[model samples]
Target: MLIIFSIPWLVWRLLKTDYFAPLVVVQIVMGIVLGPGVLGHWFPAYYEFVFTPTVVHSLNGIAWWSVMLFVMIAGVELDLGKAWQHRRESGITAGLALGAPLLLGCGAAAVLLGFDGWMGPKAQTWQFVVGIGMACAVTALPILILLMEKLDILRQPLGQRILRYASLDDIAIWGVLALILMDWSRIGKQLAFLIAFVVLGLAFRRLMAWLDEADRWYVAPIWLALCGLGADWAGLHFMVGAFLAGAIMDGHWFNQEKLDLLRHHVLLVMMPVFFLSTGLRTNWAVGGTEVFAAAALLLVASVAGKLIGVRIAARVLHWAPGEASIIGWLLQTKALIMIIFANILLDKQVITSEAFTALLLMAVASTMLTVPMVEPQMRRSRALAGSAGQST
Candidate 1:
């Protein structure tokens, strides 16, 4: 109920600002201060009402819908017309992006092993470690697109190339995570479920098409949202359904403009509550001078890891240095996506509360620090591009 108004307010705010440093950090800092660490002490019951067992369970439901809407808009905004304009290069770039993260993340898990606060306890430690690699391997394309637009590179050749790469990257990450989840070892069962997933996906389209013909666009989100619940019931995690629902809706019939309109509707309306809800989850009491140091370390690691991985991959793929650096800087961006996985781990009891707290702090603080460091270069790049155009 409270989520209804809360998300819209946040969306309104996000619309007015550039996301790099200015937008994401403000939310994280405000979230930290308003978080349970501060608010819990000052008003424990009020905090509880918003983040309580029942409330979070409810927020989980809202978050589930948010995920679907987020992905659906990604699919819709995707220039289906440009699919062939750069298919070969897009494929190679996407492959490089996904493969590097997969190997590096999985390998890096040796140092940060047993860190699946998001993988949950039902899955083994190795699986969680695998999830860690998979988590880092993902590129949140929704956020990436937003960043690209903000940087004003949306029409450049390199921009289009990275956009395609990021889209394909999103698809691969979803598939990899599906493979990395629980009940993974039983090949026969997994195969059956894979087949079933395809069947259900096809059926979802037929059903939605019929409904759309009958003027039922509203039903699409609701139906898709319910499928998330069904996925959870089947132990596949609701996000699996959420992702599948999005990909299913990617066909030609779901009007892109309509979806775009819907995108703002949710973003401006219901999304901020989710952000606030996310803030409410952080515990800032752990703050200290050293905590700041560690926060800085996490921020550096998060950005550096992505920059190095993507930069090397970009060069290998023969991208211009300019494009490579932009991709690096852009991909370095992080969001609540990492925090989501970490909290899942906490809920599954796979990690200690302190570790969960630390990672949550890491995510918020990392995102906060991201903008300040990245913005100057982004502005410079834009300015340079402008000067070069005039000179040429």
Candidate 2:
């Protein structure tokens, strides 16, 4: 552990677009060895610490914490009151984000082919395809934060506007997922579950408001943790409940900044554990040609669909050409939700191991690609902003 940190952190200063990428890659490779793919296969007891049932539960906890922190931050960062003012453009971007990704996923599924074993068409192919497609969105929130910080556009009106609509875009994704899960067959009691969800959402908002008015940020996450258990008790996945609670608080009196501070610690501390743990589940060997070919199609379609949809939506919002373009490309950073949905589907057996492998590789590839494409725009936006400042 000490040796790993002593290995020169300064090296990552060069590739500034999400420094976590390379580190995550290294961890993932190590995980492949220590996980079921290698050590779990050959020396089960040697790698046993990594995936004991207890460790599995810990990993699950980390993932839920990572995402719940994300949602809490979403609630904190978005100026929900201001966002409602632009209901028109926000509506369109939300609509497009949901519609475009689903379409792209479906397209990817159509040309989809798979394999044998506990891997491929041994299960539900079409359902897998539809699930994958529906789950392929690259959310704009985190990517925008990173992009704006890099470009010095964090405080600009364009940035604020981007935040405005993109915040709603964040909310819309969850709402849509909740809607989809509401009807999902395995979920079984979808209607009763959904009704309970809405009720919980209302209660969550009130919970946030009370905490905020009382000036107690510490209590917020406790409330969230409780909500997780409550959701479980109500026969819905706790993560889904946590997400809805965040979405429900969008325009409420919650101190977004306060929650942000609280979640920062957890997000940094627990998230890597979650990622490595999740990465351990992936058996990269089983995902061969059929999966690769499908991933190829999915990647091309996702890039095109999101870039085109966002660009057009940006124009409708009256964004400058360059802002529109950068926003469009950067929004294709689709790592978090993509991985979550994939895990859910894979666990459900809707998608085979082959498709999961394909999706993981391609989604990571697209996310990595989005950063490079965004760097140029970051430079251009900064130079343009600087020149304008000097002229003024």
Candidate 3:
């Protein structure tokens, strides 16, 4: 844990490229470096000493709860009201943004099926394909917010529009994840759980409303844990339950500033452990060349499909020049959400370690590309608008 916190700061201080590679990105990279594949190879004894079975298990527990809290916060923060107000535009853009990359990624997944190490033992061909496709389509809303804040555009119209589009896609991403994780043998229990959840959700909301603000905060984690247990009992993952816990509750119930601070603190205190654990899952048993090659293929599909889809939406909506390009690049930034999505897929045995590694690399590369690509386009657009204003 000490290593996890310190490495990112060292990288941030030394690298000095926070715009392109922020502390979160550095943490992720450090995770890979500290993982079994790299560090274990270099110093097997030291690696074993540091990450003994007990230590790894403890880390996994931390990672699980950390991600659950993070995802719950994400669900709570979703501005569904805003998206509904601009339903027409948001739907069109979100649909195309999700669909195009999904199709492209499906193609890539189809090709990967010809290989030996990409598919998990328990996954059906269709499940694996759709899982990969959805991973490609996801936009890391939390990371996007962080980046937009850094860029000083978190309150801007463009940022808000992007958030709307990402929010809609976030809903679709999790819904598809639930589908992929459905266990037919447990269908009855799953159905029962859903029914019970809705009934209980209403009761929970009323209880929360009746509670004082101080008490509500104290009770939130208990609710979070119960929801997680119920969902896992029904064969859906706990993360799904965590999301539902937050989604069913009203964001306005809590103070917005407090909620934001909780998210920031979680990222600060817990998320690095999750990143390191995710990195430890990376395996190169299929060979580094093969992994890198697959990563490249997925990266191309993710980037090209996103841009093409956004361009189509821009044409349809008659957005001004350069809007689509910037939106596309921002939308393609996939780090936290994609990693979490991929982690779930791996947990459910939908994708192999090799495939997970490839997806991880693609996410890191795509996220790193976002700020550098968007900044120049943003500058050009602002300059053009300024010139037009002066001429007028």
Candidate 4:
């Protein structure tokens, strides 16, 4: 446990990877480095000794709950009301932002289908294509907020617009996941779960409303656990349930400072375990060259499609020069959320370990590119604004 936490943190600080790769990104990369394909292959005996079945099992438990809590917090941070207020703009941007990449990513998946080891044993062609497509379209909303705050734009007008766009896309991403996970045999159970959720959700809201703020904090996790178990039992997966658990609650109910702290602490203390676990699942049996090639293909599709989509929106909406570039790059940030999305697909056997590894690489590359790409465009925008102000 200490090794898992300390190694990534030490590497992050010592290497000063934060100029492009933040601590979260570093942790994810370290996880991949520590996984079977890399570390285990290099030193099989040591790897086995360190990550024994019992040890791995214990770590898996921690990873699951850590990710569940992080995802739930992401759900709480979503502000659909704000998205609705700027519905026209948000809708158009979100639709295009999600659509173009999904279409292109499906194309990429289709190509991979021509080859072996890309699709999971259990996945139908459509499920594999659509699941991979949606992974390309996801924006890590929590990470976006963090990055924007780092850029000193989180509370700015442009930041708010980006948030609104991401919020809408986040909804679409999860809806598509639920669609992909739909099972005809379990349809009845799924429907029952949804029906129960509606009724229970109403009651949960009422109970939350009546509770003291202090008590509400204590009650939230109990609700989270029940919903997670219910979702998993219904075959939708517990992560979905964790998300739904957070979605129904209003963020305004809690103290903003405390909520932010909660998110930070969760990332700091627990999410490294989740990252490591995610890495351990990556496979290179398809060969490392093949995996890297696949990742490169997905990255191109993801980045290009996002820029194309946003550029179209820019033309349609008459956005300022270079604005689309900034928004497109920022929206393509995909570290945690895409990893989570891929994990679910892997858990359901919709994608093979090779595919998951490729997607993981694509996500890391996408996130690392974000801040560096955006900073220059932002400087240009600021310069333009300043010159305009001076002339005025």
Q: Which candidate is the best by TM-score?
A: 4
Question: TM-score order of candidates, best first?
Answer: 4, 3, 2, 1
1-392 in candidate 2: lDDT tens per residue? Answer: 22122222233344442543544333333434455656677887866864678867867766767777665555556677777787787778766755686688776676563334333433455555556666566464754565566566668776676677667766666655454444345465656666766776677666666664565356556756766666555544566666655555553454556554545565445555655665567664554465567677778877777777887777677766686667666666666556666666666466766676667666676766765777677788789979999999
lDDT (C-alpha) at residue 131 in model 4: 97
Pick the winner on lDDT between candidates 1 and 3.
3
lDDT for every model? 0.59, 0.61, 0.93, 0.94
Mind giving the per-residue lDDT tens digits that candidate 1 earns over 1-392?
54444433365376654443444444544555556767677898987776678876786667656756765556545554465577776766667666665566555444544332333446566765665565555565666665666666767776677777777766776666566555544556556555776887787777766765435477667756666666665556666666666666744666656665777677655555566566666543444443454444444555566677677666666765466666765655556555555555555555444444555565655454444555676678778979989999
lDDT of 3 by residue, 1-392 (tens): 88999988898988796989989998998898899889988999999999999989999999999999999899888989999999999999999999999999999999999999999999999999999998988899999999888777889999999999999999999899989999999999999989999999999999999999889898888889999999999989999899888878788889989999999999999999999999999999999999999999999889999999999999999999999999999999999999999999999889999999999999999999999999888889989999999999
Clashing pairs in 2: 76-256, 105-133
Best by lDDT: 4
Cα deviation of 122 in candidate 2 (Å)? 11
Task: Evaluate residue 303 in candidate 3 and report its C-alpha lDDT on the 0 to 100 scale.
Answer: 94
**What TM-score do all the candidates reach, one by one?**
0.77, 0.79, 0.98, 0.99
Clashes of each: 13, 2, 0, 0
The TM-score of candidate 1 is: 0.77
RMSD of every prediction: 4.5, 4.2, 1.0, 0.8
List candidate 4 stretches off by more than 4 Å. Answer: none
